[model samples]
Target: MELEQDLMVSERKKKPFRWHVLVFLAPAVIVYTMIMILPLAETLRFSFFQRDTITQAISFVGLENYIKLFFDPYWVEPFLNSLWNNCYFFLIHMLVQNPIGILIAALLSMVHLPGKKLYRIAIFMPTLLSFVVVGFVWKLMLSPLWGVSKGLMKSVGVGSWYLPFLGKEETALTTLSLISVWQFIGIPMMLIYAALLSIPDEVIEAAECDGVTGISQFFKIKLVLILPTIGIISILTFVGNFNAFDLIYTTQGPLAGPNFSTDLLGTILYRTFYGQQLQPGDPNMGAAIATVMFFIILTGVAIYLFFIQRKLTRYEM
Candidate 1:
């Protein structure tokens, strides 16, 4: 009888606290499914169908949309252009933003820096602002009317270099990408800074005793320890850059104008779904585009995980 009672108690103990788990997880799971997973699945499904012209009825099209998207010159050209532009944007963030973030993080990690908290707060304030605000703020700063950029350049004896960057097809995309980098550099900075802070003082002290001080110590000791954090930051940047929309949309408008030179996958998806001046909206095509984007992002992430991340050996410090 005692054994039976103990077994019952043990079984009860082993049983999951169902209400507790539900309380902790239910809301997040529900919201994530409804907002992200469901919509994504529905969009993928919609990509495989076409709507009737007159009746507005959706019919199964299998690979027809994909076929057209790849082969049709009109669609293919813009699609490829946007894809390349998006790649450039991602590359710039990787090359420029991440390095700059590392440099800033390194500087902020220095113990002798005065008012470090103030500097951190100031630097990170931009990331806290909405994309719309950043876009508009940069637009004004770069505007000829305001002369902010020009004035700064003039002060440095390079006033003649100032041009209407956003109005030029050649520079528009790059300019917008830089603006985005400026706004979000804080994210990687903060992440890396935190990782740097988490490093043991004993390790740093030992390195210092070994005659590794200043930048050399940082490069050899601190940076090696922060590789895992850097990996995380890189992946986060990848996902965010690939899914980016609002900054480009706000700064360049939905059309990604200057003769569509700044067009990215996000803007293209928006234009296809909602239509613009000359083109009528095509939901099927839009869904197809979105589905393609999803695959592209997934493929990039997979490559990062399998190739780049696997090669990066993270040291426990």
Candidate 2:
């Protein structure tokens, strides 16, 4: 009874305060709230209001702008176009970029490859350059007048298929998507490569002893282990693709030209927020668009977290 009473008394004592810990977090918290949260809150506020064109008067309009965005044919048409285009862009990345990345990483992960460092560098070099550089470089090369792409096509005996890809409605979006893929393929390759490298050699040796070799070892063992990494990359790709603007803007301008065939949400937001040839800039409408985008992204993240992420098993190394 005496020993138990002593233990209870000790446990009842209050823990020491740590005020110093707050100093480390204070700077980051304040900066993030100011930079990210503040702007987001302000944008949200703007979305529920309306501003008159002539008088420049502001008034609360509730969901009017949002309704217009979705139901008003003039607005809904462009909005839907951008949304579908964005989805297609993301789907292409999921299909093309990721598979190619997996293939390259699988190859690079194997031993005894010569000049592997050089190959890695060559693959990743485009990612290091600015969107401006990559966009302009490709644009110039693909220009009909320059004839670089034409010349190469001719040499390969497929010159007849060559056209001004960037200026055509049918090819503009796909051409840009491929360009984006080429620039960013390095990221997934490196991520998947790192994940593969981190797998335990002991695990591999055990699998080998059990006669799990060649493609069987890769598919049954290596691929399964790296699934969590793939999940992270997928979510990252989703967020990045939705937020993409720099490349399109730099290459095709804010109009996302060739009849807006390549127009995405980012470009649409830009054109709306800043005023294009016909539409005057309306902060309220712009804010409404932005608010909708935030929810769309949030929904995607939620689905990924609750559904896809839970399905993947994380193995302890």
Query: Which candidate gets the maximum TM-score versus the true structure?
Result: 2
lDDT of each: 0.90, 0.92
Residue 226's lDDT within candidate 1 is 90
Model 2 scores a TM of 0.94
TM-score of 1: 0.91
Clash pairs, model 1 backbone = none
- The most accurate candidate by lDDT is 2
What TM-score, over all chains together, does every model reach? 0.91, 0.94
lDDT of 2: 0.92
**Candidate 2 C-alpha lDDT tens digits along 6-77:** 888887775566677998899999999999999999999899999877888998989999999999999999
Model 1 is weakest, by summed lDDT over 10 consecutive residues, at 308-317
For candidate 1, give the lDDT: 0.90
